[model samples]
Target: MVISEADHARVTVAVMEAERHTAGEIVTAVAEKSDSYHDAALHWAVLAMLGVPAVLAWRPELAPRIWEGLVESWSPQPAGAPLLVALVGSVLVFLLFRLLFTWQPLRMAMTPGATKTRRVRRQALALFRVGAERRTRGRTGVLIYLSLAEHRAEIIADAAIHDKVPEDVWGEAMAALLGPVRDGRAGDGLVAAIAQVGAVLAEHFPRGENDVNELPDRLIEP
Candidate 1:
């Protein structure tokens, strides 16, 4: 999901060309992932731990079988000692499962789709605020944000553009951007989306003689 230097250059060129006919300032950004989702991992670990006791409770024979084995192995130990060992063992199992989910892929897999969507949207908005909103002279700045891990893209337009442009109008550009992403061509996706957005902006905000590049054309990798 990494964006190559060559791809970054191509995206930058697309931004430059797109702005030629539009007063809208486009800013592009890509992030490897929106979040680590440690909380999701922790939740999964807790569920797994809780399931252990639930299973034992549901199948009473299962615990007795384990106790028999422990008795044979530690006959000299106090009866209560085996219970302590079992408790410690359960804790260890929970800890191990929790640690395993710390890996990004495992953690992300356990996360709900809705959660990932929220995180991606949150990240995209943050980028928009920093990179596009409140920066353009005409308040026509737009942000195209992509979160590779979530395979999600967001197109955020500043107040001026959003007021005049129908919300659904951005859907086409977002579709264009996501098409390439779905095909694993992130750079191409961004370039195509930029062109679509430029076309839309050109129609509504035609370039003026005083129009200048108010935003950097480079792709922000956050």
Candidate 2:
């Protein structure tokens, strides 16, 4: 199909908007569908592929071999270059939707909410119940909750915590929760450990010294 430039632009904008709306859903799907390490490895490979032009600019000799390999690997009676370019472009666009638009929001929206709570329950019922306890931590007393029901595990903390803690801490906490169970009763230590983690997070992302009213009772339902 011959896609016009105007049509392409319009479609791209629409896809981006849809990605913004469903970013969380896509991230959840990716997390559930694949291991984090595997996904990270794929991302690194793509980045490396993206860097090929720059790499070749510095080391031109390697380009001949790379081109030869690509040609050799090309199928017999292969599709025309234009068709191949179109196919590859389409795949990359969809991957951008999956990796950039979808996954970015999922990471940003990693907090306890109705949608996330549902996900946690799906993953582990016992963990969901125990992890649902919201606690005030640190001198500031930020609210943090951990949930484990859905395909992707999550730690939900108050928005206040975002600027305070180093990003790596959050990453570590998530890896811990999502990683394989170390002991037979891995769930046993989760709550206390998460609470302690919350305290540490609070120190960086402190809450108001005064207590705010707990969330409305309606918001508290499982």
Q: Identify the candidate with maximal lDDT.
A: 1
lDDT of 2 by residue, 111-217 (tens): 33564555453444333234322332321222222332233544443333434555457565555544422332223223333434544544443434453423221
User: What are the Cα lDDT values of the candidates?
Assistant: 0.88, 0.37
**Per-residue alpha-carbon lDDT of model 1 for 130-189, expressed as tens digits?**
888989889999999999988998899999999999979989899998988988999999
Tell me the lDDT of model 2 at 76: 51
Could you report the Cα RMSD, in angstroms, for every candidate shown? 2.0, 18.3
Off by over 4 Å in 1: 73-86
lDDT of prediction 2? 0.37
**What TM-score against the true fold does each predicted structure earn?**
0.92, 0.28
The clash count of every prediction, one per candidate, is 0, 7
